[model samples]
Target chain A: MDSKKGMKRREFLKKAGVTAVAASTAFAAPNVHAKTKTYKWKMVTTWPPHFPVLGEGADDLAKWITEMSDGRLKVSVYGAGELVPAMQAFDAVSQGMVEMGHASSYYWAGKSPATQFFSAVPFGMNAQQLNSWIYQGGGQALWDELYAQFNLKPFLSGNTGVQMGGWFNKEIKSLDDIKGLKMRIPGLGGKVIAKAGGTVVLSAGGEVYTNLERGVIDATEWVGPYHDYKMGFYKVAKFYYYPGWHEAGSSTELFVNKSKFESLPADLKAIVESACARANISMLTHFESQNNKYLQKLVNEHHVKLKKFPDDVIEKFRTLSAEVIGEIVEKDPMSKKVYESYSAFKKDITQWAKLSEATFYDMNK
Target chain B: MDSKKGMKRREFLKKAGVTAVAASTAFAAPNVHAKTKTYKWKMVTTWPPHFPVLGEGADDLAKWITEMSDGRLKVSVYGAGELVPAMQAFDAVSQGMVEMGHASSYYWAGKSPATQFFSAVPFGMNAQQLNSWIYQGGGQALWDELYAQFNLKPFLSGNTGVQMGGWFNKEIKSLDDIKGLKMRIPGLGGKVIAKAGGTVVLSAGGEVYTNLERGVIDATEWVGPYHDYKMGFYKVAKFYYYPGWHEAGSSTELFVNKSKFESLPADLKAIVESACARANISMLTHFESQNNKYLQKLVNEHHVKLKKFPDDVIEKFRTLSAEVIGEIVEKDPMSKKVYESYSAFKKDITQWAKLSEATFYDMNK
Candidate 1:
């Protein structure tokens, strides 16, 4: 695994503006009293090294923490497979193998079904409502309670605001079109497709492009136009769909080892939390700003047909999504508890949104 | 003005975990090297003391900076009229009479017409789109350049997401209904009212309710449900309107004296900026989380009639808004430059929004 080069004590002292006299005297004696101790942390993320906005957000989060702490706390970031595989990030941080990990919470559904609600849900609240529920409503307390069981503390770090549905090889004119289709989709979305009589295939990020190109998969759900354009999905797929119902405004997380985090000095702790908040807004805005340009290219340059799922088809998926979530909640008590709060907050916020955001969009049009 | 209680040196040292021996040695000589110098600053804001989310957000921003800096920087927040009148916030921070100021940008239109674009505009972008343009697009650089001319550095600090239009005693059925109406609106919205052949009356936050009740003004616009409910506008007006086309997703700002900000140590500077970002999201989420409950109260408990402006009337406002903005750009070169960037970004993001956010809202419904 690649590691960041360590900052020398002399260089650190110089950069931190410690006087030579103070430094020399502190080092002169074995039991010399010195300034506060410095902490060096390792953060492992699920994205490939320097991958688009997701991985880049992780790097920026680390940098902001270090900068805000004035070198008193330094963090080195590792991408997927560098320190551990992408799927292993949860355990790496939970087991205290790494100080922190960055990934979507749904990735840890195997650890706890309740975790998926913290990431995204089919027909879930959008980014603003989700953030409001998590940060201001009781969502954070529930998230904390859930993660504490696994010895982790989670922070809402970034968001992919209202992701596109996916790249489709054919138009989804009705529910019948979903039958017998072989598609690569993951998480609850995959289950919904399965319920609709489709064969769900699994493909890694690097392999999805080749799978679609070679007809190994009839369709694939990736990120929106920005990342999809980079994946060259438009080159392989004939049509793209709108309103990612399966993963609306999916939130990304930074999960740190609870013990390691608690051991931090108050300033470093405050600095870390604030840095995550900054990263959250920074990443969402970054995506919103660039997605349009890339979307334009996908439509105008690549001749990809942009299509909306049929209203009836979307209604079917909505019903299937409810059934999928209902079954999970029926089986898992924690999922029930989390989903109760999630659904309640979603209901109230959606009403407000209808009058506010929804009306604003409709009026402008 | 109330000030934050100072942290005693001994308490600060104990809290920061400075070794007793080091403290003794540092205090032994008058010329002893200290850990770092502390900064105590005053921040004047444009809201009443502890006014719901807006004023409370300023308090939180100061606390975060102090916590992150570990007592190296302590900021005292003063409400409007405590240090200076609400409208004088710009001059206070710009002239360095105060280290910082918090208010909406449009409050400074007399100082520069271009400043209004940074806050909100009639039928302009929403919160997500505005943030996209300002933070990631080239809007920040232009803002920095504009604020630099006034010796201030500004940060987009908070947002009131998709505000409510206003409370009206008379229903607005068409463009003719707006004529001869006296409304307590401000800035560009007031200008639009004037263009619609209405009389625009000026009233402070504290007087809006009384004005509407006494028929001094026939209508008034406050913030969204959370604040408006507290203001008891429902008790005074019969019809409440929706889709605040005038100030949709209005952004608030924190302006710091450029020279004072530059003088801060690197860590303190980073701490302050991150604190503002944390405050930005915190306030927006706070509003989003609570507005729905209060909105339900207004509609159900008090029977406030929630109304949407008629489509034709809204269209007329849109036309007039364009003309008003056209006059501004014609008169001011800075407004032209900023509006060019703002309008272009708005056009592109609005297109993307149609496919993403707008579609997501529609599909869910």
Candidate 2:
């Protein structure tokens, strides 16, 4: 038995070493007698049709993935709710109902509060920090472990740099006025607000307008200038805010079913991840240009009334978040464990951010 | 006065109307500020010193900004906490104590529940969507409007594509196992976990290893293989997971004081933003190769144990998170307004992510 175990381990190492060599050769496949089989994948996302750079970003990923696989693998993308509702994407991929989908982790908050950890953190690390946690901070392993259970495989697809605060129907004045007010805030901030004695609401992408217009909710938070101006929010909400705390730096993903993912040739898997990574950077460049142009317009053409959150309100929320956060850690073991890890990561990275970005801005400003 | 306003508007329109013409004739400004001002800007980040990819990303931004400005914009970079604590970055920049800082939004939940919206939301848009919202979604307008009060300006800087889950001391069996667990989670996932009856801890990057080893946190999330492996978490944690739910696609930012940013030559501002944009993409590509190379070693050499999260835990979290997510929108009137605008944008653009990426992935996989 001992010999067999030793032999098995040795075999695994030998195969792995061979794989290392093969990989270095840029994915040249070993010759096979039989014809190679082609693969097809179904990818879904919550993004819209080819609208601008972002819409095109998805298309770009598809094009690159297909080409990278040398026509061996083909992917077809579906809009949100086409094969499954936007919210059901996790289940769709997990159940092998779809091959993959593009989304943000925060969207899956309904499944597990721990999921929020995978997306973005409130007052947490931005894209860089989040990336570190995921890439270097041991995030991928934890996420893979969590995802394997559902038969879902997730990959980092893209990122939107630190975001802007949301639009407001009324200007934020102080902590008192915001209490009990209705807003369309999502992610971890919702709980923070709840702790601050404020009410929170949720809705789908298509439904927020009517709700806001009809006074269903008093305020709403979204992304930044480019889309905000496109949506004509200035016409409805005169007061706009900046520096989103909830999202900070938001990330999107392409998730595939675990069984389906493992079934693919290693090269194909690499292709998909690589393609997604490419798209990730492409989206940022697209935003850099588009956001700049739209921002000039919101202020110049729209006659938009912009406002800021009151300092008192900001202070109040910051102070009360602990109550809400404490409950999360206290309520569940997994959450506590995840939280402990996250807190440490944040603390450690926090020291670095202080010197890196802070010093420059302080002096130059 | 109206004529002056009209003249300004006309000037702005001319610039936008024919970008090609502007691009062709826009002469580089003659170096006028002849003193060669050695302006020092504070830079802080969530990344540790010399950490490749993210750390280098931050450094790249500083280098590019300085060189592009002809050294007039000398930026002094400090690692996190070198200036102010990581969690206090927003306040540091907002209060003019620091010129700029790098961080994610969720960390600011303590400051404003609405701050969370600035970054990302669960089931929110991925990098593409987030960028669209920031650029065209009226997100920037709101962001700037909010930041105005804080006397700061934000420019999207670096990004990490999609992230991994985390490093775990043990394997996760099911969602139930998540209960009573300690995790270092951030952003929306932290809140969602609380909703799912789990404990979530906020942590920084540097501290995750010791916490996990010491049993301070059962699991810790950092970045992907390239970084996590470098950080040596595999030595302590046996299991690694995937499918980060917190951050989908995240982007970092270079924060500057409003007056300071405005004081710069338009070209300098443009240079800084553009440089950072390039850095964003560059970092993503760097990480891809870096992570892949190290991942093999983690498994082959380190004998790292890789595991997946149980389906039960993922499903349970998904089911319970709806209630948690719903709470964000209920507070504050403005959040609802922003959500309305964001929804419109999401509805319009989400279809694109599907038809392209979703289709290709589905067929290919």
Give residue A292's lDDT in candidate 2 (0 to 100).
48
TM-scores for all candidates: the values are 0.92, 0.49
Clashing pairs in 1: none
lDDT tens digits by residue: candidate 1, B1-365? 11222235445445645554353343322212233456678899999999999999999998998888776677889999999999999999999898999999999999999999999999998888888898899999999999999999999889999999999999999899899999999999999999999999998898988899899999998889998999999999999998798999898999999999998777778888889888989989999999999999999999999999988888899999999999999999999999999999999888888877887777655
The per-model lDDT (C-alpha) reads 0.87, 0.62
Local error of candidate 1 at residue A267 (angstroms): 1.5
Instruction: Please estimate how well model 1 matches the true structure, expressed as its whole-model Cα lDDT.
Output: 0.87
lDDT of 2 at B237: 85
Q: Residue-pair clashes per candidate, as listed?
A: 0, 281
lDDT of 2 by residue, A251-337 (tens): 777788887778765546655655665576566546543554566577779877655456566556656655666777798666677
- Candidate 2 TM-score versus the reference: 0.49
